[model samples]
Target chain A: MSAKIMGFDAYNFNFFWLMLLTAIEVGVVAQSENMAWATLIFVLVSIGVVKFIGIAAVFMHLRFSPDSNVLTATALFPVIFIVLLVLMVGLTSPSAVENLPAFCRPGYYGL
Target chain B: MSDDHGYHHGPHEWSHGAPHNSWAPIIISIGSGVFLFFFAKAFTMNEGMNGYIYDSAPLPLAIAGLAIIFAGLISWWKQDFSFDGSYEPQATHGSTPFSNVDIRKVGMWVFLMSEMMIFSSLFATYIRYRTSIDSCYSLEGTVVEPGTACWLPASYFIAKGGEHAHSTLGFMPDALVPGAINTFALIISSYTIVMALKTAKRTDLEHAERSIKVRNYLGATFCLATLFLVMKMIEWFIGFHIGPFEAPSLLSDQFTIHNDAYTYNYGHGAEAGAMTVDIRMAASIFYLTTGTHGVHVFAGIVGLGYMVVKAHKGGYGPGNSVSIEYFGLYWHFVDLAWVAVFPAFYLY
Candidate 1:
């Protein structure tokens, strides 16, 4: 029972695939022009999140570690604070939220 | 008879052995704290009416503090490696919640948590400023018409004279090739580090064979990391026009333009000089974020260099590879931070 996902041989495999995917993502973002600014930003951020998770889970061995719960908690707990801070700034600060892209605005997106 | 009498007592008793004591780490922490305080103070101090800067005199204090801190750190490292007073593993704290985990690993994780907060604050600052400036730019059309437009994307700002500028939101060159290549180099280095650790952890290989393998892998990792830095420096040089190159200094020439906006092509006329693209907030955020990440990469290189020396000396193996693992954690974090930063600062 190896703790690694898909066994030991797959570690390099996973890394290679992830790297290729990240390069492709960058290329797509750079070349694509038809995308809405908001949509492009959203896609870029989403890809970044996925790449981060891949590195953490595979390279850092978070998935295979005995104390995975503790590690995951330590890594993720600050995200709550980040989300809260963004929310507070977006809602309260007039100047901060005003020029946000159309997707972030309330009425523009039908929110 | 005396030895037997001492052996009767538990290991916790002082008689078991002399307790560990070293002043270097404490001195280093104090020095670092002092250095940080004065360094910050030097920046925030006010310039007086007669041109004498107030509170700026602390810069010397900051430098002295940094010197003391580095001295303490070097002394500590030497003491650890010294034959006369080398480090000995201490008994584990039995009461720890993570009884099964190595205490050093736990310590590394805690340290990483603090690092996360530091980066979080930097990211927050960037987001706050970027959104606010964008908002200001958006309001330009509606509010009292300003003499010039408020915001221009980084591409337009960098393109000489904004000649290629199509709309208020024009496509700017993001230096995509350099960024992509650097990303690849870092990813490869990450793989090599894992290979080094794996080689060190293998039990079946002869000690000499494992040592060679570990050193080779570490050497490869170091070269790749250095390659990444070299690429980064080249990118900055070309972008900023720091050398004799004909390209404009993006920071000084374009970002500083204040009240007026116009368009020209550096490509069209050789004597047109540099195109100005003044969006101070965007320029500031870009430099700060990328600059901070570059500092981290430099630090990681130093750590890897140390590891390479130790590997050559046969310092790590299955039973004593914690140091390598800790370094790996730090290196991985640096890579992870760049993952977020590349798209935010470059691609987007």
Candidate 2:
């Protein structure tokens, strides 16, 4: 059962999808500006997903090991990193102090 | 305790780490750090002063560092050395806890993961800068003559030019077409590497020969990559010579190399460097990002060169193709980065 499961072939997986996305991104960037924006975001998200799968599936050899704990650790690490980065950038990127309109400039605000 | 049950030994264990008196790796590390630090400092410092001394240090340090690394590799490769009194291989504390396949593959993957981030940060920057400028340009009307009645504020000029400004309206014609061709070359190389891995997995000598054939194809791919690097360098030199910033093309008048302030088009009879703002931010960033990636490609080529040397010595096969696979992953990642970079930097 383990042998069978280990060698089981799924339909096109992450690497395949990644290459496809690359081509699609090239096409989108070339033709449509709107599509280009979507493609850019999509590619970044796709890269994160594909890297997660590669690190977990191949590097950890979970297909052979069947360790549930290993799977959890591998997936959790990336999620935590991403979430932390997002939280950091979200809070800091929009600076109320710097971004205020001219009328509300610091001197006039009497702070 | 039963003889075997109380303490089971494994092939992966080795007992050499703490007792060993090897000073090579530490020395090499320090030497490399010093060399890179000096090299970077040289770039930031004035070219006239202390340049001679700083430039001289790196080459000798690099050679000595390589010598130490080579000595370590040779020592590691030797079969006679062992922690146990017996010459025969033993299960001890320092033995690598990985099959060669696993260790090398993991190493490669780890390497590629870092590389992916490097490329990602660059692409992300390009996207942010491009979107900001695009929105600004559309919001404000067509860029017009500065200091005229209709001229925008110095702050406005400074903000546009101060932020991510572009050095050129579009990429020079030569750079883009060559870049596209190289993209195709990289894709083809990825295909060839897959074939090499497939051939290595076969159980026959003919398959081994086929593996060599595939490796040769891989080498060809490297050659193509090298050619692409050469073409890119040539393109950069030509751009420098032509001065992309000083002149203007049909699309927009606001681009230059040193700074990206709004400049009047040369065709529109504006003087060289005439502008309320310098708008070369986009182009400079574009060059720096792509140029750094190009350096990575060059490093990958060196790795491939080493792999080719080992391949000739019969060091790789189905059991040992992890290095090849990892490098292939890196090569493709780079190509994919360029795929985004070319369009984002050039087309938009």
Candidate 3:
């Protein structure tokens, strides 16, 4: 008989699926060179999902735990930190000057 | 398995609370922090690439930190706390073992938290580049202006020919394909580790002894991690093929320093000059972030070897397999981080 869902080793199972999804997302990103930025964003979010699943199901040990608050903080804090950090970095960086005629040539703009 | 004194307070007794309370880790942390501070100052100060003069302090500080941490661990070894740190029954009675797990796991979680921040910063930098052809196009949402001077320094250097002029708009290096292959390798390793964990949890000890599956899993993870590093080195070598094409642009510090643009407005029969592809910033940061992760993978390889040795020594099983499981968690964490990193930095 299959193991009971309630008693299933959710840590291992979720990690397995998360890794598989991560592999698939990597393939998608690899092959989607011609895809739109919006579609790329979608792929990124999928990657983010896999990341969350790994963190939630394993590192925080949420699958076996009874407390959701601990899990929520554990999972949410890194994300909040990432968002805040990205925002801070974005705000501090000088906006790229798009008006220069030399901007688009490969080696003209430092980027 | 959840016995409070046995699992939690056991290691505390092993070290007798004496060795574990040393100031070594704090000193090590501070030393490294100070080194990083000075290192940043060295860069901002523009200390003229004199590495022998400037890098001396940071290197020593890092070495001192390593020495301190290693000494502390060495001193703490083979003591009462060596066996089971949490459950020191005779001394510190009624101190629940749950308290130990709480702190220990929380610390690991926090360390991983810092790791996330580090990688994210790199990813954010990459996103800025992937979205824009140039700084102007990046901000103003306007189409890239045509006929900018293309610097082909790298091509000139590598091709051993007179400067060939071409447009820079459509230049791309083929780094993504091998990177993608490495990505798959890590994924496969993660699966193998999970399989190992599964085998460890099974009831048959004799079968587990004979199977050698966990050993194989750990070995595979090590191989894949090494493969990723090798491929990354190859990618850097490929960047060298473009000569000055890999140099950063002179226009900005945030971007790669590509050669200075010299405009030539020859009318009618003028062909567009060859614009070099500057892969320096992209390739450098790519290596830094991913390379650091690769070092961590190497460390994990060592950790896995330790785990395998201990497993052979019969230190882990279904009843007391938390150590192996924690290692598994860390391995998977590394894999998950790469899933985002690969696309964000390379494919996108």
Candidate 4:
């Protein structure tokens, strides 16, 4: 199905924005000295997220098709696992085992 | 079950009543098991032993397993090649969420979910190391002794143009050229794949013209995918010199996985010369993430090669265009991955 976004061809619209975001991503890094890195990082991450959504929604047909909702749900099913992994990573990420939270440490429960 | 259940079978169509009939899956499993077993036997390394143990005896067996795997892959490809979307199996009408949807489409989404988990773990590993390790630069002039392990992001060599830095382009570093090109290549390739899918579904064009257009678009995608890998190699190993400008590859700049003793200059003054630091962690993550993506790109090139030939033979048309859509999902996912990787590993 042919899709449109703001009166522009959906694919073309997404492509245009992806390119612009990428240019800005590079430009932001290139001019890192002129701006706070935190601001630059925020901009980079914002652009990345937008480009990602645009590609997934329009190009990958995660938004337009009839089964889009179900398929998108299928695609996102692993997100829970991903979130769990991230949380787990935070616990064990430090170099020392002793640095881990008490519950994560062995013999903490006094088996 | 009916004979036309639309499940892929072996060399020829199978008898309907005879279930679990395909030999491809069994053969592939055996081949993979044998390959891994022999390959592991071929190169054994033990920490408590005398270095690496090399045995050429298992090498032949490993090659044989590879040959068997190739045979099974051919069988699988043949089964798919026979499909033309005429009999696309859809879920039966029911109360289920996926009822009436193309089964293959649902299957593809399920497959993408697994892929998402794989990349997610990679990202997790990257994040953990990044948050834990102190940056080598941040350790400069500190009490933290030289040769201490630290994270030195790839962007140092890339976006920032480390040590012997140069910039031919006014916008970005010379070292960042390959990465920048790769980003654009992936984006363009993503668009081309979409165009291929769009053109495949076109009813207006003449059959021959449409076939040629689909083939060309697929060919373009294949070329771009190949170009991304080539640029990756250029960035990783073969530094480039373009007339008045020169950019050292990560290897040439000593930003390598084996770089346990990398020199990090504190500043310009004579007293603040440099300190040796271990940056293997950052390099490892960089290679693992980008290399994983590179492997995906390479796999896409192979798939696109087949698609190009198939489209040239008029294997795709308005009726069979779902083939392009399935592959398009994969290609777009690859681009989506780079959307995260480029900024995280290259720009940041």
Candidate 5:
């Protein structure tokens, strides 16, 4: 995007953050024995979201570009569907995994 | 409608300007449908009401479908190969929100939106199973019978190191080495591809020098993507050893889609409490999700391959660099997908 962040190139800045966050992600998982599993998961997910935003916003030029808004909205158009899919399958059904159709389960299609 | 260029039969013609109507899309769809139908038939040809037998009688028809698909692809590429960014395809005539934007860029985003749906559905399935089933570790001391299906996350084998966990890397398990390296490789490749686009758009540099720089950057990106897939193979099938370093592949660790009776050691040495479990679901989803990501990487590798060849031929420059920008969009999306996948699949 040719934009700058903290006087550094935006892509480089975002790249640096992505790498550091990924290292922390791996480090947290490696140190699982020393921390609570819940904490580890939280950290992993938090870093994951940040890294996702970083890649999408900076690397993908969804920020600092003239077309960012329209394109970002275009990219996010599937969020509602994704949330609905997760909600229907994850929260609404307590036994969604168990009730999964035979064809959809593992070893059914032999993939 | 131009009289000079009668049709899109030549590589020198611009695509968006002509009244171009091609059968490639329909041909591809027909080929895909034929391939899928025959592929299904191939697997079921030997099935009978009385019993079961293996059969692949329809395989040739499926291969023929593949041939058709390839033909369609060649038709599409031959038309697109000569595009030098002379005409930017934009939705300018419409009152739609995407007016004045490159239609190719919009198409890319829309395509990525659909991809988001696919991946989100996959993640939904992962979450569904991750929550619905009891983890194998949680059932270590339970009264559950053997052969019960349970979640034994790939992270157990990768991040925590299952039965064959080794500390050769000192900080992380040896198995984590491949995934960790792949993560960085993708991130670095993201940078390199951007550099390629930047170099392609440079106006001051000599044509030879700019083309050389762009080709190098793209070539570096291609190498990194190849490295990512190679590491995936090594982590999934070929266990490796380097002096004091050793990491077992998932296959070597008995994690596969067909594994219905996996031997899960409960972190106890040679104990009677060890139990047999059906870890096929976890293994399947692991492969399904990461395998899907791997497919995307492989696809990127193919695209990068073409781009490297094009750059080598000095086919990119300030006027045509939008190709690299569009490609960078896809490449960054791949990196973004891995951002979620590496943590969810390999770390957590």
Candidate 6:
């Protein structure tokens, strides 16, 4: 059975909706002032991840491709990179963290 | 039947035709090598290197390399299009992982994968710096150095009207209007390109009236991509004050640069002091990431311009739509890269 949401083509409509949703999410994140820094960061990062995957799956047609191995391998790079980033940040000594790149320093959490 | 143009008679002859001599690949490789060598050399050179002046020392080599590279590209393109049947899609090896894919499509995919690595490294660097910096500059211009347990108060980073609290690491504009509009433009352009590919595939070039539809769609895609660039340039001019102009632009009033320290005022009036931060690393990362993406966008526009010209001549059809699909993959990848970049640089 063909999957259609809101009477639109599954692929094209999904992309359009995701784009709108992301824009809305960005607007909310930018305008809302009450959210905690950690919450704001989490929301923005989650939205970015979703948007990236959505574009790759639908727009790039990786979701429907027969060779999932190659597509998945390529997709794993970003995940691995992010994980490495988190590990690096978490494991670094406090003194060492002070010497990390300017934006990576502890002082610029939500800026 | 055997022919003079290197055709041979055999049971496996259909798959084993004699290879024709082509200089395009070698010329392009040589040109690209020369360009990259000089380009890297020039970029990496510092002051007082080998007793040579740093500013103008590599100019000649770089220019010559660039000229040769362009010449090679133009010649290669001309050579490819010279033959009548040159546009025909090639057969792929049936035993390979890419058996069902067009060779050009596979090539484009591989190229994009490499590009992903390039952006990955840039983003990784940005994230590393963003998460590790330990110093917080308060609105009152107090530097909170890293202690055994360094922490910032909530008021130091909150976004306020007209003026928000700045962090020592870096500060992005809180408005998000320019970024949101640019995002929408790029996403819409992706849709238009997909539509262009669909129209091109359905087009019957034998009928002049039907062919025009393909051209129109491609033209629209071109215009939309151009619009994305225009919007981005406008945003940069206003937000970063990057373009050439004497008059003060928007956001210019918010930024204050003193020595190596940069301060951003997030609150209104003189009551809220600016958030002072080290500007060098933050500015460098910002420019490097966004600048690299903009270069990719510019390159896509140039490629789209070529495709539009070819579409006008009825160069694409159902049998030869692989080129359009290839271009679509690249264009979409560009959009995908922007997806990550917007949030990283603007919203976050």
RMSD of each: 6.7, 10.0, 9.1, 5.9, 6.8, 7.7
Off by over 4 Å in 3: A1-34, A58-60, A64-69, A94-111, B1-102, B124-174, B206-213, B238-273, B276-284
Q: First chain TM-score in every candidate? A: 0.73, 0.42, 0.56, 0.79, 0.81, 0.57
Which residue pairs in candidate 5 collide?
Answer: none
Taking the tens digit of each residue's C-alpha lDDT, what string does model 4 give over A1-111? 698888988888888888887777778888876887667777888988889898999998989889889888888888899999877973366563544435557886796
lDDT of 6 at B113: 72
- The docking category that best describes candidate 3 is incorrect
- Sorted by lDDT (best first), the order is 5, 4, 1, 6, 3, 2
Clashes of 1: 3
Better of 1 and 6 by lDDT: 1
> Candidate 3 on B105-168: residue-level lDDT in tens?
5455667778778877876665444333342213222322343322222212211111232213
Q: How accurate is candidate 1 locally (lDDT)?
A: 0.63
For each candidate, what is chain B's TM-score?
Answer: 0.69, 0.61, 0.61, 0.87, 0.87, 0.71
Model 5: CAPRI class = acceptable
Query: What fraction of the true interface does each of the listed models get right, in terms of native contacts kept?
Result: 0.42, 0.01, 0.16, 0.69, 0.71, 0.23
- DockQ (Cα-based) per candidate? 0.47, 0.12, 0.19, 0.45, 0.43, 0.26
> Residues B1-348, candidate 2, lDDT per residue (tens digit)?
112323433333344331123454465466556556555544443443212334554566556655665565445333212221121122333444332223334444455555655655555554444433423332233554452222222212211222223434342232233444565566555555545554555566664575577568668767877877875664454321245543223113233243324443222234223334434445556667878878778866866776665565555665545345556666766665565565445444
Writing each residue's lDDT as its tens digit, candidate 6 over B1-348 gives: 224434322223323221123465567568767876876676552352212234557668877876776776666555533322223333244635554444455556777877877887787776555555543432234543222112221112222213333322222233344456678877877777777666666644454554577678778878877877776665445542333212222225322111134444434466655554444444456667877998788877877776677677766666555567677888888888888887666655
Segments of candidate 4 deviating more than 4 angstroms: A95-111, B1-58
After superposing candidate 1, which stretches have Cα over 4 Å from the reference? A1-4, A7-10, A89-92, A105-111, B1-29, B34-59, B79-97, B135-174, B238-249, B256-278
Cα error, residue B176 of model 2, in Å, equals 2.6
Candidate 6 interface RMSD after superposing interface residues: 5.0
For DockQ, the strongest prediction is: 1
User: Model 1: which residue pairs collide?
Assistant: A99-B135, B155-B172, B161-B275
* Per-candidate count of clashing residue pairs (backbone under 3 Å): 3, 17, 36, 0, 0, 15
Candidate 6 docking class: acceptable
